[model samples]
Target: MMKIYLALALWMIIAEHELMSGAELICKRRINAEYRASVLMSPGYPFAYPNNMRCEWVIQAPEGQQVEIIFLEILTESCCDTIELRDGNTSSAGLLARYRGNVSESIYVSTFGSLYIKFTTDDSFVFNGFMAQFRTATTKTQNCTVKLDASDEPQLLTSPGWPYGYENNLLCTWTITAPEGRVVSITFVEFETESCCDYVLVRHGKSMRSSMYELGGLLKRPFTDVSTGPIIQVIFRSDSSLSTSGFKIQYKAVKRTKTDLMEIPKKDKCTGKIEIPEAGHGTLTTPGYPEKHENNMNCVWVLVAPPGMRVSLWFTSINTEACCDFIKIRDGETPTSKKLGILSGHSTKFAHYKSSGNVMRVDFQSDVTKVYSGFRAVYEVLNDSSEEKCGGDLRAAINRRQYISSPNWPNNARSLYCAWNITADEGYSVLFKIIGFHTFRRRDSIQFFDGESAIPFASLRRNTQHDDESFYSQSSNMYVIFRPDVTTVQGGFRGYFVAVPKRQRNTTPSILVSNLLGQHGRDNR
Candidate 1:
């Protein structure tokens, strides 16, 4: 028997070599339980196989006997070049195993009867393919179908005959039930299937009758579905055409937590109020101004300009917690108004807001932790007619104060050139108070001139440190000029000028002189 096997093996090798080189020969032989082989090689034997080739062979045994095959070496183009095994020779035979990837140890057991092997290669990457040996098994094994049931303890599931293309007209289903209030997540370690013709469907719910969501196509990565409750069902179906290597899936169940829920800030209980004047503008800040704001707090500002004019707002700076804390701008004063946009995180670009009517609302909310530097914005009247032209003349009575504002004050000040000639009744000095100021630092400016010459008494820009301070002019006639560039715009200044009578005696000091004269004067004498 051993001599006969050796002779057949040598003859098969010689025939394979000749056939690979385009030669043909005829031989008649029958394989039975006694058939065995020490080695089997691809067509080219030890040399690299030619590209774009497909080949098949069959090894058979008697009834009630299985086949066992072991790989000695395998080198081929990874996935693109494949060697596949089947349980029988007929077209109805089911797939058993497949080889790809780099050379590795491989062993396979086939069902009763015979095992068929197929090798295919692409146009590129030719390598010396695999070599293996096979023999008929002396004992019987279980049937080829696969079954799986996954619970809290994770389990792996696959197609009917994994690592190989499933037989035609097959329907397989696996049910996975996790603990109550927990969801299942499926991670694909390996996957391949006929995309539309033969597919795997994954549905959520206790059964298919309840709810269903298909797993789409074979994925290269893992997929987790938490929306579906605790139950998941997977179904695999194959058609009667081309088959492919199936899939391997790893599944786990995860519990629901508090973070999964969404958090909405309470707007009705916010803590700020803002009302910008028709010709005036003002700066609004988060609770802590430039510092990080407190967590778990909601701040709201209601901005109202003149009746005919609309309100405009722009953020000078914003740094806040991402997602958890945000600033929402609205077009109207109520909660049901049209929503503009919500902003959060550290942003380099600026944000601008415009109201449809005379009123606009802003709301800010913070979460439990990770507070950051809040925000500062200026809100002022958007004068549709004025075209953001600042500077004008002002005349006030003695001991009276008059309001003055930047062009389109509170709104973004565009490229502008304007001047204000402020005069009191010839005898009073002018006092200027900086109410709210924001502009391009140093580049855009508001200057207080002594008279009409180029010399300036005070120059102000977006310097937050000193913008809030006050400045007084010695002369009754004061010239104020504002020039803003178009490239960088910001909320301009809001201020007022008050006229005071010159050389007015200090009334409190005069009263002190009268009180001291009657008693302290006699003691001094």
Candidate 2:
């Protein structure tokens, strides 16, 4: 006859140490308090183990549902990881749980009655709080946008290509610094009048991957990074047109050293500009190499409209709404930018004489030398404004001392798409562009696999949460949720990648990261 053990404990782990370091409560919750405790685990009392290592405990359950325990005294540690249930099993040998001990790890036990669960660890620095709470079973939560004219964290800083103007597929540059181990991802959401198109996402300077609608593209591979976050270059594009008034990349994490954040690269600085030939259309700043702004709404630049120079300012605007959006153009150093004219049309494209667009003919009218410029617009954003969609913002970042590694320069601009339909804790199919990679260093047993070179989310392995086959259908570049704010790149994600490359562009800007700005940030220069 075989003997079975049941583990029951109000408290599983009890570590009463005098010289305890690298120990943490992490987070804990009573079951039913919040359904999010674990997308995979059921709502119940948060189960935790207390010993320094070798978790040992038991739980008493009602006679009928003993098989609900997914894990028992699950022990987690940093550095290396492994999985060992009460049945003396491992991630290998086709077990359900494996531990690489690299990123993170946990142990689980399954049974309905009283079960004995124990776990141990080698790293003395880690001690996670495995919570076991009691709550009713619920569905998973889907991430949604929070429409805002006001936000907890305001824009603080921005570039010229916002509000009413975007270059279809354009490249832009930004700089930032961050501490080690932090995550940084950009956000571009908007409430358009349903007339605008969907936008694309990119990581300029690093990888150029458009939206992922399907799974089998060469651009869906997973990339790694070693640099501190507040990563420099991140790109975004408009899938459809939209009249964006606000944008932001909510704060996340940064993992690097302090030294690296302090001594970052110094690219083009926002300065006064000089007049140059065919600089740009529609009143662009010259003299100042990198555009500079003192306040959130103020910037300085030099514009030229010489006598008989045959030059006209060009721009696109929102025409669906009854009222008009204003772009002010001014000359001189009055502490502001000027709007040469208004793009009062409904369409987003503009041309000179031979087309159906708005253009300000430079029949040699405006002054030449007194070439200073400023731009501004104040108007209500209509509910269904058939203008632009999607908005983005500048979040936080950190830097490190040691430089991150990488593969080749300008990783091939891979384009892809995805289509997913998921419910609750079940989510899968990750479409990403690779920038760098490293070796595994933990004991893990989660069912996962890799795709072809560029098409990462294409293929996968069979394992626990991932084995359900539903994940493969619910993943796409535009809809990635978990770790939504984190990205890895060669030489660290902080190294930077250009958002918009010159080859494929119209208005969707690019991201260029050369060096560190001031104190790990550029305030959108």
Write candidate 1's Cα lDDT for 128-229 as tens digits.
888888776533222323333445666787776788666765555566777666767676677787764556656555331343434434667765544356
Q: List per-candidate RMSD values in Å.
A: 24.8, 33.1
Query: Clash number for every model?
Result: 0, 161
Instruction: State residue 93's C-alpha deviation in candidate 2, in Å.
Output: 14
lDDT of 2 at 491: 13
Candidate 2, 376-427: lDDT as tens digits: 1111101111221111221111221111112221121111111221112213
Error of 2 at 52 (Å): 4.9
How high is the lDDT of residue 65 in model 1? 62
Off by over 4 Å in 1: 1-269, 272-283, 304-309, 334-336, 346-350, 385-392, 396-416, 434-442, 451-454, 461-469, 485-494, 500-525
Q: Would you estimate the TM-scores of all the predictions?
A: 0.39, 0.17
* lDDT, candidate 1, at 381: 72
